[model samples]
Target: MKPAVLSGVHFITGDVACAEGALAAGCRFFGAYPITPATEIAEHIAGRLPEVGGTFIQMEDEIAAIASILGASSAGVKSMTATSGPGFSLMMENIGLAACTEIPCVIVDVQRAGPSTGLPTQGAQGDMMQARWGSHGDYKIIALSPISPQEIFYQTILAFNLSETYRVPVLIMTDEIIGHLSERVVIPDESEIKLVSRPRAKGRKDRFLPFEPGPNGVAPMAIAGEGYNIHVTGLTHNEKGYPDMTVECQKQMMARLTGKIQNNLDDIIKTEGYMLDDAEIIIISYGVSARTCHTAVDEARSQGIKAGLFRLITVWPFPEDQICRLAERAKALITVEINLGQIHLEVERCVKDKVPTYLVGHVGGTIITPERVIETIKEAT
Candidate 1:
């Protein structure tokens, strides 16, 4: 029998690393429909899962794919699904359902350029805003950007831990570049890796309230067949998990749904800063674009430009306060992203006219090179 962790060094694409990462994190169920740039993950995990005593299913489509994961997660299994642009769009409605019902699951979106199937094979980070707002209504979700195959592995594990801890869906915001790029990923022993399972409900099953939050503002989850009165729904619910459509129920439910994530931002968000202490110019980016930012920052510094790099590991919460602090002291801020200007607007919003903000924006189908970023730095000055 194959080991669950698949411990050791290996050369692999980011997609395979992601599949291995999910297994290492104790993910037992994967439900996805094959989609371009993201289908390899489902194919890889499908074979590996059976060896590890897990389940993998290819549903009718992306909608059913995500719906299956939500149902699987409700039964107290760690669940995930992967897709590209069009499929990701199809999963939005059910993604919102996961949020409303506080189901712990992960969605891997290896984004391709698109408003509607713009590019299938080419890479793009065009899904940044959609990851946060694609699902309707007001909900707080976590999204992580991995710079490489190695980091995507770790980020995948982190996604599961956070979902279980917060009882909310987490997103791995990857792109086709990193998703298909080959790299060396070191898989350590299972003993060294950290894993988190959902907070299980205890005490008498008769009085169990599935939606009632514990001390951390996140409710303990009751499995579907665990004899608990689990009443999961997408509608406004009271602590008893029953539909409560009144004003008080709406407000109370909304508060916890958003607050559980907002209140715990410190734990959920992760970012990296380099050469920032005395920076007059700040270049912000994430995912594969961030790989170029690293070189761009070095090139700027070599040219005697007081530039620094602020790479976002977690994108959804937006890192508003951190960007604001940097903006206050920096002479300028530049956002590098493949989208025309999704994250750039957020950076400009956080700057609040404090600094002259600029965007090194790209439409799709390519990467913004370090030289292009340096050119923007010269222009910003």
Candidate 2:
């Protein structure tokens, strides 16, 4: 099949940009629900997928949405889904299932303010922790937070590549502001866009072990109906793809699941550092808040505060080593987010008294302004 790349620049919302990214990345199946701040993504892809001979299904709900994506992916198709906080919560069980069964799929959570349906249209980074631990268990996940329409486009493609490479559910954790905001996005040609396909199982079908890992701790997957002995279950299973309830089997299975991503941190973790070379106070932020933090850092620099900005593009692996290195050199660390102290705790953990850590955040329904971030920077100094 010909690649479905719209090779040009277009002014579009982040949600629309994301859909285009998925299409460019060769995502052939999208199973999603209509949820606020994220519905535009589903709407755009639903129209576009059919044009490329892809499938787009609006499931009855979020749970079924994710389940269907997993099914499609197991059939050797690149699949994805998009939702907001409530819908994301509903998909948690299946998210874990995707992780346990080693399925490749992307989940986009365009976050809105919420404990439970708190604000449908407002933006918040409250789901940072949930994106990491929402699914029950000790599996590792990859999550990217985008600050703009252009970035979300690239990040969505990256999300798919990572999911396929590691055989895990990757998340694009955008917010209402970024999702609804429109800007210029450059869509590269099919030849220019990098795509990663899942590693397919090779060797005799009769001798194939579905869950056996290679040197990288990632197993080559076999699609259903490929004539290989494929047995997939959420329960602990052996390399032969049969359930094994022994503690040793559980230990080995868990290690491969988590180790695949953790061992490849150099490739998976991405962050941007601004003016960090000669700064005493560092402001760490992600998503929409990072934009404000950048402005605040510039303002602080104008006032001779020696401040810097550390923006997280990949948030899930936590980027502990980089944060720790920055903490050791900087006098203080400030974490800015729309939610109250979710990523702040992570900063504090990394710092561990190496430097004082401060949180400049608030409850959702509104954004944290540059002035407020500047004020916190001054206070820290």
Best model number under lDDT: 2
Q: Write the per-residue lDDT of candidate 2 for residues 1-381, one digit (tens) a residue.
A: 444888898999999999999998889999989999999999999988888999999999999999999999999999999999999999999999999999999999999999999899999999999999998989899999999999999999999999999999999999999999999999887888899999999999999999999877889999988989699999999999899999999999998999999899999999999998998999999999999998899999999999999999999998999999998899999999999999999999999998888998888878899999999899999
Task: Report residue 69 deviation for candidate 2 (angstroms).
Answer: 0.2
**TM-score, structure 1 vs. true:** 0.99
Structural similarity to truth (TM-score) of each candidate: 0.99, 0.99
In candidate 2, stretches whose alpha carbon ends up further than 4 angstroms from where it belongs are: 1-3
> lDDT tens digits, residues 1-381, model 1?
689898899999999999999999999999989999999999999999999889999999999999999999998889999999999999999999999999999999999988897999999999999999998889988999999999999999999999999999999999999999999999999999989988899999888888889998998888887788678888889999999889999999999999998988898889999898998889999999989988998999999998988999999888998998998899999999999999999998898998898899788899889999999998877
Q: Give Cα-based local distance difference scores for all models.
A: 0.93, 0.94
